[model samples]
Target: MPHLHGRVAAQESVFARMSRLAAQRGAVNLGQGFPGTAPPAFLLDAARGALGRFDQYAPPAGLPALRDALGADLGVDGADVTVTCGATEALHLLALALLGPGDEALMLEPVFDVYLPQVALAGATGVTVPLTLDAARGWQFNLGALAGAVTPRTRALLLNSPFNPTGTVFTEEELAGIVALARQHDLWIISDEVYDELYFGPRPTPLRILAPERTFTVGSAGKRLEATGWRVGWIAAPPGVTPGVLGLRQITSFSAPAPLQAAVAAALPVARDAGFYDGLRAGYAARMTRLASGLRDLGATVFEPRGTYFLTALHPHWTADSLLDAGVAVIPGEAFYARHAAPAGLTRWAFCKSDAEIELALTRLAARPELTDV
Candidate 1:
């Protein structure tokens, strides 16, 4: 019998496990980051129209028009963009292209769950630098820790802005510090900006804009369009890096679905003109506010998010399992950390859910006030 890959067989993803538990318990699931809403009508219409015209494999790099649209959105040349199955695949391809045995990648903690695994799969080590969580300031980047983590063997810095689980959008100062380190160390920068358009405050500056020579920007049309099922994503690399990404992509998923790529291409311009992004930001802001307020009312300390649809909260007495038992599901903050335990009692909740769903989870939580006393 053949042995399975060790990491692949070790454990199911916490997100998948929690979502499954939520289903089994018939609870309002706030564990995963997927949006509860559908993509806007115009985007759906474009997908339908595209499906009628494009049914074959797209060019491994992407449909030319989609690449062009992505380039326009990211302020990069079209030839530098390579479409991928999702930002997940883009990250994996990057690991394969830029890292190997004896190399290290700097990962900011709470890291996205995929970063460490992908680095391991590429035979590279992930060096994690934990961010500080201030009650008033939210998550703060530790420039000193990042600098200390860099080694001669370090190959890349993997970054996520409008960061997941914590929803901390990296500030320009932090980004600049990171860029400076990348420059000083001669390391590659893989910027995961899938949630770029979902910011609540000022938009985050792309790292590529600060250090184009060594940065690769990864984006997700699915996240921006509120259609995670589409799985349309791309990497906007510097000209020299694009070809390697495209080559790895050819053997990975080959290309994202042609119609989906076409649909995203068609929708990007219309979404921009119709203020779809503004509406998305406004809607998610309301949801986050509602959830945060409810958690506060229940004696939980909520970290107000500046962007993204998730927030981390501290309820010393409540665990994620306890929340699930109370009819709502969430992810434990520890799931995001690679090297350190999450601050005691922190858990991540997703407000990407519909208003009613958010309210129901809050109501369920309110009914179990004793859970917080335990």
Candidate 2:
């Protein structure tokens, strides 16, 4: 038997904790970030058909059709694609393949919870730079602070734009600043872009598009297609990362489900088009307005989002324990940060659910003021 490193040792994840409490209270859950509704009709229908076809193990990389469709969408080739169970698995494989004991990966504060754990479990230190939100810059952070955080040990930069919890879209200037640093230090970048198509304004640009030579972009069928349970995702990397990512993927996942891959292949082109993505943004925008306005009316601080399906609220007296007791389940802002303390007290609520679900949750929330109780 071997002893696990302290970084790799963990308790229950934030998702499990909030989900379990939500179940127990029968509360209207805005904690879990997945959609409460079914995927689009075409994707679901494709999934059903996929069940009847290739029931065996999928190809190690992915179904050729799915890879080809993704390549066409991303402007990459099939050979550079490495499909995995989900974006989560893809990140894990990349971490294992790239990081060593002394390596460091820099991720933003108020960051995604999934990144730190994966980086830590891979025997690498996960460093943090903070992104703060206020009335002025919205969710933007100081580029100087980020630049100062890097060191010689920093081997990579982990990015999740259209960021979760904050919903801040990294502007072209911000990306350029980060790219300059990476180019200076010769750092690899692994981006979490699962919400790439869920923008509320102008289309978001990907890091790979800017610096394909040193970038690996990971995305999934879950967010845009509303198929979280399907767990089909792909990593499109530059040729430099081709060998390690492809080989390590086989060891971790072996193969993602053939049927889900087929279904995602059918769904990719639909999700790739501008009209479909715009419709998605429209739907989420309506819900965002509904929830963010309600929170503001309730006298809670709300940072409205530019992209992604999350709504973040800040209040002094919020906590996971208190929110669960108040019958509206949400994840605390503290859950998202690993190194730096959250700039203020906050909570994140998922607005990806049905309209009725979002309404019901907000209504229940309005009846209770315990969320702001100090």
Over 1-374, each residue of candidate 1 has an lDDT whose tens digit, in order, gives 99876677757899999999999999999999899988899998998999869899899999999989988878889999999999999999999999999999998899889899999999999999999988777788788999998889999999888788678787788888899999999999999989999888888888889999999998898889989888998899987778767778889988889999999999998999899999999999888899999898888888987777788998878889889899999999889987988899899998999999999998888887586553
TM, every model: 0.98, 0.95
* Candidate number of the best TM-score: 1
Candidate 2's residue-wise lDDT over 1-374, tens digit each? Answer: 98886764688888888988899888878998888877888888888999979699888888999899888988888789888999999999889877989999998888888888888888899998888777655677678987898998999999888788788888899999888988999999998899998888898999988898989999988877888888888899887566777788778879899998998888878766636777778888998899888877767788888788997887767666776776778988889877778756688989998899878877776777665443
Model 1, CA-based lDDT: 0.89
lDDT of each: 0.89, 0.84
